[model samples]
Target: MAWVYLIIAGIFEIGWAIALKYTEGFSRPWPTVFFGVSMTLSVWMLALALKTIPVGTGYAIWTGIGAAGTAILGMILFGESHDGWRLFSIALIVIGIVALKISSS
Candidate 1:
């Protein structure tokens, strides 16, 4: 289903984002390869999702998932701040995403 593809793409968005950090400005060979692969797969899956999903809604959801997930991972994996405001913002994004999905039906 298109939703499935979108979700998978969002997950890969997270992967590539984290992997990007490990790339060390793309100087690291292995992480660079990982970033490239992850980025490619992420985009491909998103495109597949677009076959069934409307471009506007799908794009907003995809980027919302990617941004929120990446921000959360940054706090957990990296030494990014885990402030209340940050968590609250992430929660807002998630809530908005849920609203979008619910309204899309």
Candidate 2:
């Protein structure tokens, strides 16, 4: 289903984002390759998802998932800070994504 594809795309988005952290501004060859492949897959899957899902809703969901997942990963793995404001903002993004899905239905 399109939603499944969207979720997969979101996962790939997470992959690309995390890989980007390891790429060191593309100075590391293997990590940079990983980043490139992950980014390509993410966008490809997102395009596939748009085949069936409404573009606006699908894009919102995809971006929300990417941003939230990447932020959480950054906090946990990359020594990024997680403050109250960050948590609140992520929660708001999640709520908005959910609202979009609901409204689309």
TM-score for each predicted model, relative to the true structure: 0.97, 0.94
Considering every candidate listed, which one attains the maximal lDDT?
Answer: 1
lDDT of 1 by residue, 1-105 (tens): 999999999999989999999999999999999999989999999999999888988998999999999999998898799899989999999998898888888
Tens digit per residue, CA lDDT, model 2, 2-105: 88888899988998999988988999999899888988988999999899889989999999999999999999998898999999999999899889888977
Task: Compute the lDDT of residue 79 as modeled in candidate 2.
Answer: 81
TM-score of 2: 0.94
- Candidate 1, poorest ten consecutive residues by summed lDDT: 96-105
Residue 88, model 1: lDDT of 96
Q: Give the worst 10-residue stretch by lDDT in candidate 2.
A: 96-105
Name every residue pair that clashes in candidate 2: none
- Give candidate 2's error at residue 33 in angstroms: 1.5
**Cα deviation of 45, candidate 2, in Å:** 0.8
Candidate 2 segments whose C-alpha is farther than 4 A from its true place: none
